[model samples]
Target: METSGYTTQIRDGLFDPSPRDSIFRVKAAVADELAALDDTARIRSTDFFNHTFAPDFVLTWPDKAERHVFLRMSYDLNALVEDVALIDSHDPFIFGLTPNEGTEKDSRIDGAVEESGAMFAEPDALERLIDRKKTDSTANMLSNAIAQGGRGTFIGNEAVEFASVVSRGFEAASDVKAAGTAEAISEIEERLGGPQAWRMNRVLQAVWEGSEGPLMLFPGKADLSGRLNIESLRYLVTYMRTDDPEFWKRVGRGLKMADLEHLDFAASRPNIERLIKANLDILSARAMVLVDDPLGVGEIDRESKFSWDIRERRLTFEAPGFFAFIGATKKDLESVRKTTANPVAVSTFVDRAEKAELAEVTLHSGSEVFILKHEDGAIDTHRLVGVSGQFDGPSEVTQAIATSSSGRVTVDLTAMSGTGQTRSKIRLADLLVTATPLLRDLPYEDTEALNHYLAYEVDHGGVTLDVPDDEESLVDDGVAGGAEPDDEDE
Candidate 1:
């Protein structure tokens, strides 16, 4: 399984393959286990056992109510394996795998599709581990695999050695006992808070120049500050294990990859968008930022009310926003840039938007000639399903709103109409909007992305986006100084 001598030189490429075929072979074994789930063809004994308990504690089903209920996950690994194996056969130099110079302005693909020999990923190890959770009880099995990876000889031992180095660092960390383990994780996170810290922590090259195997732990970005996370070490060791007790919990626990110390920041319960994103076979890890946040259109008539529909391929969505369709895939995100690039249609949003300037009402629900005021405020008297509209008492005619593209107000004229006469009145209310910056490409701006820009003051041509005053995170930047803080010496 030694890969040190066969693959690309570590100083050279970030995306390189392992010299050992065993790694993929082991992964292929894992794939077989997951594929077993779909093997309904396999006959099993009628007898079943019951031992289900959830740390989150929710009744998932009638019989299995007390146990932690897992959502199903499935993918065409047959295709994935083909793609992975394909990456091994060719070098970018020979096959044009590296990113072209022109692609610099464009976003990087979540998975490298077209390459110029620059970057290559061999079935990401972390992704392979997470993918196991889709099958029944594979989380526990994968945990066992990861746990064994470290202690056992062969490839597993290599995994162990890496974990050992991380553990040694964690224990030796000065912040260990003083702040408590969890808090220490927080402190280490604070230390690695900036995007650059993460980039620095990455393994510079995927394949090393010479090694018995890929150099497991080259201190390219080891934290000497003695505040690194214990789980960082533990994750390295047990990430591949499904039977590791915490495997399912880790995957099932939280959907969002919050900031380092965000373990303390509680999630505001899961919503529709989150549920789909977490449970889908292919999660769109791509984060999107909002150029202009959309709002809801007031409830109106059938002809005037807004409506939206979801596309077949799309699965992820950001709510109470613009667009008609509701879901998307990774490829769809790609076409946005590849396409004309003007007003890129991301996925199939319902295009159901409410423009304050375009507010209008065609159907009057109840011959109630109430003043339908515009911009003053609006309400949903009948309650829209996929449409948004409004009616005021003192106003006459007003503009219109695009609820689907903008907000989540719904209307079902089919349900609430009388002889071609509209009959509902909804008063308008000021938007109760919560402004959260939309995250998109370049979201994970690790040091690699901002090469040579570490702690460079923004005033002196440092890498800084013109973030809105209200939207930018002081917590993220670690420079809480307000309004206009000097970027010079503290």
Candidate 2:
């Protein structure tokens, strides 16, 4: 029975859409017949069986052109099965529906079809050809589907193309000879709008088990040399593994956008910390330079162990020889001026110093003793004496005194011994400067004297010393011996 373009035949029940009249039953019959053929014969003619005839016959049996092409393919497949030698001589059938062919026979197809036929004729080549054909077909199907779904915009078009290339590359990742995957990935990255678009596409984001997944979405080192914004960086940090050294190496090649001062540090802190831990030098340096404070100067704890100099608008963290200064300007408290240090560096330094057993100070005022490093590297403990008001002296001298009072003091006893015994009285500023390294290691105190001094300095620009002039009187008399004076100032 002939219906429309399809020719219904009853030969061994094959190609017969019978009582059921289902195209699926006809395909099953054809599949069974193909299965019964010799493995070599079937494998050699897989392209013919799988593509040229079967799909068209099953998919478009009602179309006259497809039906006519299917009949021709069916005749060829049967003839080749019977003769076997015919498979080596006959040219493979080409699907005319392919847009690239455009009704003209593709010259490129002839050599490939001839080569496939020759390979099929060889017993040893059948298995390799079958494997390769399967891989190629799978990759082609993925590419074709991506190509067909264009949104008509330039970015949309490139995005579709990017997805196609990525899909094909991943599909062939398992093939040992597929060294072109990396090259293909590079080619697609050049055409892509940006890395952010990678995760936006469901096809690109689909993770392949035991594969790199969207890792190839990252721009190559040469491409990443340009600046990336916080959002782009956030995308990379979110998807890329911290443990992957290669990911960091690539990230290190890129420059971050200059205006990250406005970045949401709180939301991005975890990612930034992860990058810092991964040894991302660029981000590390940037973190040390940009200051982000959600809380402005008013909320700053002036008397905290970590010194906040209201006059200088600086918060200092001191550990032995290391000091990190971070603060905001009056103009913008959330972000420090370009000249000021980054607040992020404050926490980073704290974490590092604590991990290294270098320094840890409480922010609140407490009875923690001051740590004094002597000239011999031996640490001496001293009970911190409560002193009131800022030291009155030169601006530079008072600044030095404020620094010393803020944290632990390192004194060089060897340097102070010469001038100490002879002098009954010394300038308070001079004594603080000469005896101590001027280190800010202690928490800030809200003492009436210090507050008054800070207030006077802020208003009048300087304060005068009110303490006793006697040098011996400066030391806490409660200690067994007088204060071991240090000469070498830090």
Candidate 3:
């Protein structure tokens, strides 16, 4: 009944039996109706006046990631009554127009942001699942550290296996999933049992152990998957383990890499793989930040700027610093009832853990995190660019967090000789984040016109923020790296 959400059966009722003659019949009917009209005002009221007569189909670049986007178009789903009026009265082709349109977000993955954000939900209850600290296991610790560090190397080199990079990124991000830094990288080995954190670390160990390469890999796909951008995740894994033959075996077979000759890698004879190394080296240092607001909303804003050349093969990313403000709300801590195989007297416990844990935490706004802060001329709304973090609060609080007057517009930037840093600056109604000029050791790699800021907030007991600045400009080499990032998730 449908090819792109349209029905062939509906086509027969609107027009004559001969589909080929419909256009001509509609045209003749239109001519007769126009001729019968005495005034222009009547003509303007005709059915044709409100419709788009003709439109153009946009040509696409096949190799670009964003090429053919699909959007569901519901406006034309209804079958209209046959009009005795003007043009296209018998045009069966009118029914053939698809009600769906191709979308334009090329960087998007197979799933939408909301769908991908579901992975961060709680895996199991506390008593049901146990935590396994990983850092105590020297062998895994070494392997994990190597893979994590090699992620940096792979970021400098694009050929690394995609799975390897993503696994490591996920492990690093998941470390912050708990209430505290009880399981820092140094403590992972001891924490490695069967907890969500351990399971993620176990996956990272697999990527490292997957054929003498970086440990990075995860499931192909899952519905409602959070922070689960397939290709982008794959790209990170591939970045660290390019030498592994199996890496190419899994991904290239499915994506038709050889068939895509129009891509820069396919066309260039001089330096096909030049950008590979350049991008890897830069992004390797760039921190992947995790943000949690009250609304099940998280964002990744970076202080690190990336640089890449389309003509020449070059790229870079670095993390000068990182910051985040995470909060919880009553709505996010609701109890969940579950039926399990090992039912123990239908037990009941107050769910201390935030039930809405990290659900919807993802790179929906573009990358792994979104930058929600922007510039406005108000005294409190100062700009704090190059920060990374998400709102770790419950969904209810996300609505409470104030944003700029203009609707939130998230953008990715490219830079040259620019600093690669990640930081998150959370500003509330009374709380303000002032982007102070560079002071102390700044993260900027170059002396570009970079904007910076500091966050002010209140914790369990007292207000938090350094003393207000006395001067506008800085006294040091303009590097302000000393400001401690926001504290542990509560």
Best-fitting candidate, measured by TM-score? 2
lDDT of 1 by residue, 1-490 (tens): 2223112222122232553443333323323332331221122211111111111111121112121111111122243223433433222201111122331322332133233121222222223333444542323323332321111111113222333333333332322222232232332233222332242132111111111112234333344422223333222222222233222222322222111112211221122222222222212121111221145332221122222122233321222333222111112222221111121111111122221122223232235432222343442322221232343322211112212111222221111110100111110110101011101122233212222211121112221211213212222221111211123212
User: Candidate 2 vs candidate 3: which has greater lDDT?
Assistant: 2
Arranged by lDDT, best first? 2, 1, 3
Lowest lDDT 10-residue stretch of candidate 3: 343-352
What lDDT tens digits, residue by residue, belong to model 3 across residues 1-490? 1221112212222256665464334333333322221111111122221243321111122222111111111222222111101222111112112223433212221121222111000111110111111211222222322222211111111212222333344344333222122233323332222132343344333333222222223321112222213332332332232333333222221121111222333223112132222111111111111111223211133223321112112111122332222111111112311112111110110011111111111112222333232133211111111121232421111100122211111111110001111122222111111111111122333222222211111222222212112122112101112222112210
Shift of residue 291 alpha carbon in model 1, Å: 28
Candidate 1 runs further than 4 Å off: 1-158, 164-312, 316-361, 364-373, 380-490
lDDT score for candidate 1 against the true structure: 0.23
Identify the candidate with maximal lDDT.
2
Off by over 4 Å in 3: 1-5, 8-10, 13-15, 18-432, 436-490
lDDT of each: 0.23, 0.27, 0.21
**Candidate 2 lDDT by residue in tens digits, 108-178:** 43333333331111111112222333334322222222211111111112323444565465444423124
Error of 1 at 472 (Å): 28
- How high is each candidate's TM-score? 0.22, 0.26, 0.16
Give candidate 2's TM-score.
Answer: 0.26
Better of 1 and 2 by lDDT: 2
Q: Where's the lowest-lDDT run of ten residues in candidate 2?
A: 394-403
Q: After superposition, how far is residue 313 of candidate 3 from its true place, in Å?
A: 19
